[model samples]
Target: MVTPFQVHVHLRRHLMKELPETDDAVAQWCRDQFVVKDGLLDKHALEDTFSDKELQEIRRPVKSLLVVTSWAILVSLGALKFLHWSALLSSWKGIALSAIGLAVVTVLMQILIRFSQSERSTPAKVAPAKPKNGGEPSETRQNKEQ
Candidate 1:
């Protein structure tokens, strides 16, 4: 999961400007600038600011972390069920283990919730980039010039 701090760092590194001091402000800035539709960053909207390689770099870690965390929770739940079925949960050690598992799941859930909240915020529309010449878009003008 990508924390607001991580998003702030990425924005700072990519945009090279001072950002809002608070995490919520930084997150809001991201929502305003980028197209986040349905809890996902729109890569097409990011094309103007980030290269394909950079987009992939930003996406990979979050995807991998989510997958790993989800699998961990599932495995932990399965283990807890097995322990209970075998009557191991009757012991103090088993109770401790269950508590630890519950705590881990709780933390993971909180992370997921935060991420969802950040991504699911209302996204501002990105206006099309217009050419200063006022004849055509920059891309088309560039193509014609070439």
Candidate 2:
């Protein structure tokens, strides 16, 4: 079985020699190189499919979100500095804000991690139909009926 990591390494090595000149060329190259299942390049069909420009565009919004989030956190911290530590901890609103901030940061980190990974290309495997009534499979039964 060819792993997705192996496929990524292969694509990167080949692409380094000759990058596709256009989007259509890139799509053609991908199709010729490996089977694309449901528009995804990997066998597992996770979120590991994106062009270079698409990745750049995704990163742009994520970067802006991170910057804004960071500033908000800094400002929150500055505001909290004026209050006593006990008061800050006892405040439910402050706790909720901190939780929300942590969640947003966690999601952004996951997105960054996912996009930083390489692409994969492999054929998806189709499982055989299970036998019905402890007899022939559905396909065989249908063929017999026909």
TM-scores for all candidates: the values are 0.27, 0.26
Positional deviation of 89 in candidate 2, in angstroms? 2.6
- lDDT against the true structure, per candidate, is 0.68, 0.67
Cα error of candidate 1 at position 51, Å: 51
Q: Return the lDDT, model 2, position 112.
A: 100
lDDT of 2 by residue, 92-113 (tens): 9977876787799999999999
Residue-pair clashes, model 2? 0
Q: Least lDDT summed over 10 consecutive residues: which range in candidate 2?
A: 50-59
Candidate 2 CA-lDDT value = 0.67
